[model samples]
Target: MNIHFIAIGGSAMHNLALALHKKGYTITGSDDAIFEPSKSRLEAKGLLPKEFGWFTNNINSNLDAIILGMHAKPDNPELLKAQELGLKIYSYPEFLYEQSKDKTRVVIGGSHGKTTITSMILHVMNYHEIAVDYMVGAQLEGFDTMVHLTSENEFIVLEGDEYLSSPIDRRPKFHLYKPNIALLSGIAWDHINVFPTYENYVKQFSIFVNSLTNGGIMVYNEEDAEVKKVVEQATSSIKKYPYSTPNFKIVDGITFINTSFGEMPLEFFGKHNLQNMVGAKWICLHMGVGEDEFYEAISSFKGASKRLEKIAENNNSVVFKDFAHSPSKVKATTTAVKNQYSNRKLLACLELHTYSSLNTEFLKEYKGALNSADTAVVFYSPKALEIKRLEKISEEQIKNAFEQDDLIVYTNATEFKEFLFTQNFENSVLLLMSSGNYGGLDFTKFKDLM
Candidate 1:
C-alpha cells in the first residue's frame, strides 16, 4: 500500500503514519508545522516530510490513497492536487474503517472519558495477553503508538472522537467507524464552532447509534441522564448493556472497587473513572474476558495521560494536572479530587485555555464547577485572547460567570505562579486543570520549587 498524508504531524495522524510505515506501506506525509514528540517520533521512523508546508509536487498518481487529517483545510495545496488528480481521498477515520472493516471493532465514544474507557479496555486486553489492534486518544504507559494495526488481530479498539473527520468530510469522526461493539459515556455540548447548537451537537450521537452494525452491543453509562436518554432513543437492533459507577470506597486517599473476588485497589480515583471501569467491564465481557479476569487485570491499571495525572506528590502535598477545560470536565475532575481527599483542603486552579472555556457566552455553564475547592483560582492570558481574536474579557465577567464570590482570577502567568508559590501546601491537594500549559510554566521545575 502507498499512502500520502496531509497534515500528518497531528497527534493521531502521525500515529497512523507510523502504524502504516511499520506495516510495510510506502507512507509519505506533509504538514504546515510539526511540533515536538510528533516530530521526533516521525523522524525516528523516517516518516517526517523533507519540508514543512504542503507541496503540490508531493501528490502523484502513483499514490494508492490520501489520508487527510482534520488539521488540513479544504484549501490545502496538496489536497487540491490530490483532488485534481482524481485520487481516492479518505479521512483518517474512513481509512481506519477501510483497514478494520474485516475485524470486530469496539469504539468508545462520548464528550469525555472516551480516552480513559478505551485505555482501560486496552490495559485489560494487554494484561490478559489478548492481541488486538487499537487506537486511543491519550498515550498509555504500555502503548508505543496511539494507533496500532495488524492483519492477524481479530479485534480493534478505537477511541471515537466526535469532532469533524476532515475539512472535506463533514461527518463526525466516530460516524465513520460502524462498530460491532460501541460505548457512549455521556454527552456534554462541545465543539460549538462546528455543531453551533446544542440540539445539533446531540444529534451526532444519534447518528452514531444508528450506524452500528447489525446485532451490535452498546455499553452506556446509565448514571448520565443525557446518555440514558440517548441510549433509550437508539432504535437500532443492537443489544443494550447499561452500566453506572461501580461500588468503590476510598481508603487513605486510595480508591478500591468491590468485586465478588474481594476489594481490588486501583491507582485511579473518581466517580467518572468508576463509571469508566463499569463501562469497560461490559465491553471486555463481550470480548470473552471473565469477570474475575477483568478485575485482576484492572487492578494494575494506572490511568490515561493528562486525565487527572499525578505530576508531583509528597507525603503531605500532591499536585495533579488534568486536561480539563470544558465545563463538565472541570466540575467532574474538581469534585472527584475533593471527594477523594475529604480531610484535606483542595486548592484547585484552572486555566481558561480552550476556545469554549475562553468564550464569554459559554462561561456561565461553569457555574459552581469549582465549588468543591477550598480556594478556587482561574487564569487566562490576555495574549491568548488576542491570538484567538476574541474580545477582551474582564475579570468581573469571569467572576460573575462562575458565580463564586471568593473566586480569584489572573490574567498574567507570572502573577498566577507567584500566587501558587505563596500558598501553603501542607494538608492540601493542588489540582491544576487545563488543556494548555499555564503559560510556559515548566511543571517539572515548579515541582522542585514546591
Candidate 2:
C-alpha cells in the first residue's frame, strides 16, 4: 500500500510511518522541519522527504491513504490538495484503529503515566518473547521503533493519550482506539489551549471510558479520587479492576515490592510508578500472563525514556531528567526523587514551556509542587512565550503561584544554564523536569559534573 504522511515529523506520526515501512508498505512523509531523533531515524530508514516543505504534488490518487499528523494545520497545502482530490485522510489514531480493530486492543489512558504503563507491559511481553503489536510514546531500550504492527499478533498495546487526535479531528486520541482492555492511570488538567475549562478536560476521559468495546475490561487507579469517581459512575457494561500503589519499600535507594511470591526489587522507584506497575499488572493478567510470571518479568525492567530517567550518577551524586510538566507530574516526580535520596540535598529544576504551564490562570495548580525539594528552581523562556503567543509571565507571578517564598525563577535560558553550571554536585541530587528542552540545555553535561 502507498501511504503519504502529512506533517509526519511528529513523535507519534513518524513512528507510525516507520512501522508501516517495516511492514513492506510504500511510505513517504513530508514535514516543514524535522528535529534530531525523528530526522535521523527517518533518514536511516530512507523514509525522510527529499525536502522539508509540503508540496501539493505529494498528494495523488495513487496513494492508498493520507495519514495526517497533529502538527499539520487544517489549511496545510498537502491536506488541502488531498481534500480537494477527495482522497481518504485518516488521523493518526483513526488509521491505527483501522489497522488494529481486528485484534484485542489494550489501551492505557490518563493525563499522565500512560506511557510508562504501556512501556512496562511491552517490556514484560518482550522479555517473555510474546509477540504483540504496540504503539508506545517512548522509545524503549530493546524496541527498534516506538510503533510495531503485524498481522500475526493477536493483541496490540497502545499508550492512549487524552490529547486531540489531530487538527481535523476534535475527539481525544484514546476515544479512537476503542480498546477491549483499557487502563486509566489518573486525571490531571492540562492543555489549557484546547480544553479551556477543567470540567471540559475531564469530560474527555468520561467519553474515553465509555468508548470501550462491549464487555471490555478496564483497569483504573482507585487511589485517585477523580478516576475512581469516573469509573464508578460509568454505566457501561464492562468489568472494572481497580489498583493502587503496591506495597513497596525503598532500601538503600532500591525500591522493592513485597509480592505474594517474593520480595521483588525494581530498577525503578516512586509511588506513581508503583501505581502504574499495579495497573500494568492487571492488564498483563488479562492478557494471559500469570501473576508469578508478571513479577518475574517486571523485576528486570528499567523505566521508559525520559520518565524520571537517571541521566547521570556518581559515587555521591546523581542527575535525572523527566518528561514531567503538568502540576501533578511535577509534584509526584519531585516527591519521588527527594524521598528516594532523603540524605542528599535535592535541587529540583523545572522548565515552564508548555502552553498550559505558561498560562497565568493555570499557574495556581502548581502550588507547592516543588516543596519536597531542598531547593527549587523554575525556568521559562520569554522567547517561548512569544512563540506560543501567550501572555508574558513575571517571575513574581510564578513565585506567588508556587507559594514558595524562596522560589527562584529565570526568564532567560542563558542565565539559567550559567546558574546550573555553578551549582555544586557534591552530596546533592538534581532533577530537571520539562516537556520541552530548557532552551537547548545539554543534558550530557550533567554527567561530567557528577
Candidate 3:
C-alpha cells in the first residue's frame, strides 16, 4: 500500500509513518518543518522528505491513503491537491481505527496519565512476550518506536488523547478509537483554547465513553471526583471496573506496592501513577493477564519518558524533567517529588508555555499546584506568547493566580537560568515541568553544572 503523510513531522505522525514503513508499505511524508528525533528517525529509515514544506505534486491517485497530522492547516497545499484529486484522506486517529478495527482495541484515556497507563500495559505485555500492536505518547525505555502495527496481533493498545483528532477533524482523537477495552485515568480541565469551558471539555470524554463498541469494558479511576461523576452517569450496560491508588509504601526513596503475593518494588512513585497502575492492571486482567503475572511484569517497569524522568542524579541532588504543564499535572508531579524526598529541599520550576497555561483566566486553576515544593519558580517567554498569538502576561498576575506570595516569575530565559544556577544543589531535588522547551535550555549543560 502506498501512503503519503501530510504534515508528517508530528510526534505521533512520524511514529505512524515508521510503523507503516516497517509493515512493508510504501510510505512518503512531507511537512513544513521537521524537528529533531523525528527528522533523524525519518532520515534513518530513508523516509524523510527530500526537502521541507508541502508540494502539491506529492499528492497523487497512486497513493492508497493520505494520513493527515494536526500540524497541517486546513488549506495545506498537499491536502488541497489530495481533495482536488478526490483521494481518500484519513486523520491520524481515523487511520488508526481503520487499522485496528478488526482487533480488540484497548484505549487508555484521560486528561493525564494516559501515556503512562498505555506504556505500563505495553511493558507488561512485552515482558511476557505477548504480541500486540500499540501506540503510546511518550518514548518508553525498551520501545524502539512509539507505534507498532501488525496484522497478526489480536490486541492493540492505544493512548487515547482527548485533543482534536486533526485540523480537519473536530472530534477528539479518543472518540475515533472506539475501544473494546478502555480506561479513563482522570479529568482536569485543559486545552482551554479548544474547549473554552470545563463542561464542554468534559463532554468530549462522555462522547469517548459512548463511542466504545458494544459490550466494551471500561476501567476508570474512582478516586477522581470528576471521573467518578462521568462513570456514574454513563448509561452503557457494558462491564465497568473502577480502581484507585493501590496500597503502597515509600522506603528509602523507592516506592513499593503491597500486593497479595508480596511487597513489590517499583521504579515509579506518585499517587497519580499508582492510580494509573491499578487502571492498567484491570486492562491487563481483561487482556488475559493474571493478577500475579501483571504485578511481576510491572515491578520491572521504570516509567514512560518525561512523566517523571530523572535526567541526572547525584548523591546530594537529583534533577527531573516532566511533560507536566496542566494544573493537575503540575500539582501531582510536585507532590510526588516532595513526598518521595521529604528531607530534600524541592525547587520546582514550571514554564507557562501551553495556550492554557499562558491564559490569564485559566491561571487561577493552578492555585496551590506547587504548594508541596520548598521553593516554586515560574517562567514564561514573551517570544512564546508572541508566537502563540496569546495576550502578554505579567509576573504579578502569575503570582496572584498561584496564590503563593513568594512565587518568583520570570519572562527572561537568561535570568531564569542565572537564578537556577545560583541555587544550592545540596540535599535538593529540582523538578522542571513543561510541555515546551524553556527557550532552548540545554538540559545536558544544567545536568553537568549540577
- Candidate-wise lDDT, in order: 0.92, 0.93, 0.92
Q: At residue 34, what lDDT does model 3 achieve?
A: 97
Total backbone clashes of candidate 3, pairs 3 or more residues apart or in separate chains: 0
Worst 10 residues of 1 by lDDT: 441-450
Query: lDDT per residue, candidate 1, 1-450, as tens digits?
Result: 889999999999999999999989999999999998999999999998898998999999999999999899889999999999999999999999999999999999999999999999999999989999999999999889999999999999999999988999899999999999999998998888788788999999999988899999999998888888988898989899999887789999999888887787898889998999899999999999999999999989889999999888878888999998888989999999999999999999999998778888878889999999999999999999898888889999999999999999999899898999888889889999998988977788547745
Prediction 3 TM-score vs. true: 0.98
List ranges where model 3 is wrong by over 4 Å. none
The weakest ten consecutive residues by lDDT in model 3 span 441-450
lDDT of 2 by residue, 71-122 (tens): 9999999999999999999999999999997999999999989999999999
Q: Which stretches of candidate 2 lie over 4 Å from their true place?
A: none
Q: After superposition, how far is residue 90 of candidate 2 from its true place, in Å?
A: 0.1
Q: Residue 10 deviation, candidate 3, in Å?
A: 1.2
The estimated TM-scores of all candidates read: 0.98, 0.99, 0.98
